[model samples]
Target: MMALFRNLFAAALFVGILAAFEPLNYKDCKSTFKINSVKADGCPQENGKCVFKQSTFKINSVRADGCPQENGKCVFKRGTNPTIKISFIPDRDLPKLKASVRSKISGGSTFTTFSLNNDNACEHGIECPLKAGQTYEYTQSVEIVNTYPVVDDVQVNWVLSDEDDSNKKEICIVFLAKITE
Candidate 1:
């Protein structure tokens, strides 16, 4: 009887650990723009930002069909489209901008390119000639095709560059994701 109780306790502890969702980890690749916050469908929002614990920034599990965390990584289902919203303030005026999305699997040096419906930032949500120091919200839908292999620990990178000078990146963000069936 005592052994049974011990086993039950151990199982419960393991399940609890798995249920604790870690905060989304993101980085500004170019450091040219200030990312105010990022959130998906089910994350809690407050004061125009996603509400997360201060110390660890742990997020809660999302609803079904929404981007949820499993094994401490955000899960994106194949053949489904997930929308991501980002708030940022650019340092310089961006008269024209182009968007690019790419993914790099774990331990892989080469990145696979992905396409958005329209590569123009102005077409998506941003107004033409974005003013500096003004916060702007940009929303995009990522199409996860059925052909993509089920991969773990994939680095998804999104960049907005100047159409005139491709080298000048206005904003660059990289986040971790997992693709599942």
Candidate 2:
């Protein structure tokens, strides 16, 4: 009975810290392939074959396009000024990248992935501690200054996960996506 009570107490404390959103952080996904929104014209349907979504929703600082199962990247034309912003980032960090990575876009299982490469401050690490039933957020913006005419579509996807078990209590993925064109 005493041990049971002790476990309950610990669980409560963890819940409290997570509720506070303590272990919070973000990763700015950069691609060798840059994006240029103005030149790219519009996010393609059938890969630039469709009209841009026209809604009055709030636009996020980062603009992201959907990732296709077949395409390895979200493409953009070389001269089209790259827009390398992370349109949607989860409130929590997912598992660390493995050379033999296994990932599914938006819970779907057509595993299409790539190696995560980056710089300091946005290095390989974990961020967590966002309460269940609560929402936390992070945003990143990058201008795709480099554009190649050869490129066609620009695809992106976001995943919130708790791959780091060391900090069991601190785990989250704040979802942030582009709301405007």
The best candidate by TM-score is: 1
Off by over 4 Å in 2: 1-127, 142-149, 165-181
The residue-level lDDT of candidate 1 at 118 comes to 86
Instruction: Supply every candidate's count of residue pairs whose N, Cα or C atoms clash at under 3 angstroms.
Output: 0, 38
lDDT of 2 by residue, 1-181 (tens): 9999999999999786333221112222332111112111123223222112211111122232231112223343322322222222233334332111122334344744423333211232213332222222322222333321222333333222233432321211122122112
Whole-model Cα lDDT per candidate?
A: 0.63, 0.27
For candidate 2, the C-alpha RMSD (Å) to the true structure equals: 17.9
For candidate 1, write residues 102-135 as lDDT tens digits: 9899999999998798888777667878787777
Clash pairs, candidate 1, are: none
Q: Provide the lowest-lDDT 10-residue window in model 1.
A: 55-64
